[model samples]
Target: MTADPSSGAAHDALAGSLKRTEIQRAPLSVAGREIVQVRTEIPPGVESGWHIHPGEEVGYIVAGTVEMRIAGRPTLLLQAGDGFLIPPRVPHNARDLGPGVGEMLSTYLVEVGQPLAAFTEPPDSASR
Candidate 1:
């Protein structure tokens, strides 16, 4: 409900270096819904803690490679321009894998009839 906390620190991007500016908290249906256009930047050798989401995920690697793991499965390395899709409620996580940094556009979709609230973050019990 509060404004999204800014990244504060700088990170690399597809076009050039960037700083986190905004994360538009979005709504999703039970099956899922796409996320708003919130930009992301990751620094070289840096990674985020594993986390989960309520919606199914589909993404395109806009720049660089990413190591993706669904349900804690073996990581699949994705390169720039590559795309992937994850089923709903399937625990998954990804980290920038290419040298320097990487970028991607992510989306989650929901089937007809599902409530939008179902599209949200994982249960409080998940890791960060």
Candidate 2:
């Protein structure tokens, strides 16, 4: 199934001023799965709130820099030409740390019909 840009967890996250442009969506050879590609523009200092995808996300930074925080892992500082992978259902947040907008291209391999992403509470929130 093709991703619907207007209705999904990804769109909900984008409400925080991130610009998301759908690049492509196509069924994968694997049954019950599809791949969705998106170009995301993050304004400087903005964070993509902790969230998880229904499947894995393979992403590449296209411009600027970002700090990637994934639960149970060391935070990563990434810049243009860098690439990263997020495991399925792993909550993570990406914050743009830059003087200009940060651009990223993400391709998700997800179960058909599932939302691209679902927001979650920060991993450390319960201790507060």
Candidate 3:
């Protein structure tokens, strides 16, 4: 699916932090599902705010270093050649921890008509 630049103010707000380039999108054999591939670039010290996907996301770190924080799980320190998976609706965030830009390739199997990702309040925010 193509991202509409003028989609909404929320999307524009999120885009300011992380750069996401859609690589390909195709319909999946499963009814009501589609696969979307994206290349994301994160600047040093930037964190992808906590968010949830409509389905599952399979991602591979392509460059630099990153820390993956999935709610309820131990944080993972990843580098190029490392891969991770996020189950449907699980809140997670990726932070660039690098001397240079960090890049990741993510492929998602998601339900059609829903945004690929939806940002949410941090899981631990309630305690703050």
Candidate 4:
């Protein structure tokens, strides 16, 4: 296993300028694989622009609420204790629906050298 290679570049490219803390990160026991655990705080009404992950993302809502919309799915409103998944390379977006800030804990299974996420334009509905 090797050290995590994410260097905050993905967060810098996030749409709504959310704050992120790397809670736990380590390369998977398997060669060339890694798992990144991050806690993100989204300010009220802020939305992450469309983005895609290089790998699958599994997340848990920890505080407040969020509206998550994947390219081809209806918006899902998630509250604390809720869980969600974003499939690899699928474009999606999210917004904080909060009286205060919204928080979430997320884990990603990615290739060791891949960026955590990549910003992108929303996928056309017809092609989604």
Each prediction's TM-score against the native? 0.57, 0.87, 0.88, 0.85
Q: Could you arrange the candidates by lDDT from highest to lowest?
A: 3, 2, 4, 1
lDDT of 3 by residue, 27-113 (tens): 999999999888889999999988889899999999999999988888899999999999999988899998999999999999998
Please list the residue runs of candidate 2 whose C-alpha ends up more than 4 Å from where it truly belongs after superposition: 1-12, 125-128
Q: Write the per-residue lDDT of candidate 1 for residues 3-89, one digit (tens) a residue.
A: 234643222121133233334435544333445333455565555434443455567777877777665455678888788887766
Q: Which regions of candidate 1 are displaced past 4 Å? A: 1-35, 110-128
lDDT of 4 by residue, 75-113 (tens): 899999999999999999888988879999989897877
lDDT of 3 at 8: 19
User: Which 10 consecutive residues of model 4 have the lowest summed lDDT?
Assistant: 1-10
**Predicted model with the maximum TM-score:** 3
* Poorest stretch of ten by lDDT in candidate 2: 1-10
Instruction: Give me candidate 1's TM-score against the actual structure.
Output: 0.57
Clashes of each: 3, 0, 0, 0
- Residue 75 of model 3 has an lDDT of 88
lDDT of 4 at 64: 88
Q: Model 3 off-target regions past 4 Å?
A: 4-13, 125-128
TM-score of model 3 (CA atoms): 0.88
Ranking of candidates on TM-score, top first: 3, 2, 4, 1
